[model samples]
Target: MYTRILVPVDHSDTSAAALAEAIRLANEQHAIVRLVHVIDLAQFAWSANEFLDVPQLQSSLRESGEKLLTERVQQVQEGGISVESELLEIWGGQIARTLVDDAVKWKAHLLVMGTHGYGGLTHMLLGSVAEGVMRHTHIPVLLVKATESK
Candidate 1:
């Protein structure tokens, strides 16, 4: 019964699985897919050195994020699913928060994302984005766990 499905893709294999699942669901339900890719400059801030300009790095990151979103959007569209996409840039804060906000903005009925399937110490240390979204978002979230490829 979902009219809009929000998918957060990060150009990872896990994310690919999530997107594929979203597309299949969208096709089945005759819904629209809203794909998002967030460019958080904070991730690269520490890598910025005396030789690198923060502004330039941010721009580069935005470009790559948009490219990733575009590729996903194209794939979804080709699958006969109605699709739209956005490239977001946030200076700080968790990516999960950003996706939740975007889901509200787009009036998404569902959220689909990829989880790394980490537990215990690793989960505590890395902090799971999928877990954060599941905890904070109001809509139903479907998490697809991605594992290492051989």
Candidate 2:
């Protein structure tokens, strides 16, 4: 029933797993997939001192994000799914909010992404974006938890 699937990709194994799951779902539902790579420039903006070239850093982030999106789009296309992609840049904004806004704007039927599944200290230190998205939006989110490292 889900016709438009939105997947956030970061080129990590966890994200690849999520993409695989999204591809399988898309194949079964004959749905289209949209891959999104978010570049949070604000996170690095704080380090923009006299020694830091903020503009160059931002450009590099955009280039890497675009590359990731292109690679993911190709993977989805290889799965014989109709795929499109977007590289979203957010400055001094929440990544979860940016993702939810894009999904809502695209009218996506589902949102699939990977979660690192950190707990305790790690979770406290690096807040979970998936958790944030879940709390902020009504969209159906399929979070593929990362596999345990060997």
Q: Highest TM-score: which candidate?
A: 2
lDDT of 2: 0.91
Consecutive 10-residue window with the lowest summed lDDT within model 2: 42-51
TM-scores of all predicted structures: 0.93, 0.95
24-85 in candidate 1: lDDT tens per residue? 89988999999889888887677636677887888889889988988888899899998989
Stretches of model 1 off by over 4 angstroms after superposition? 46-48, 147-150
lDDT of each: 0.89, 0.91
Clashes of each: 0, 0
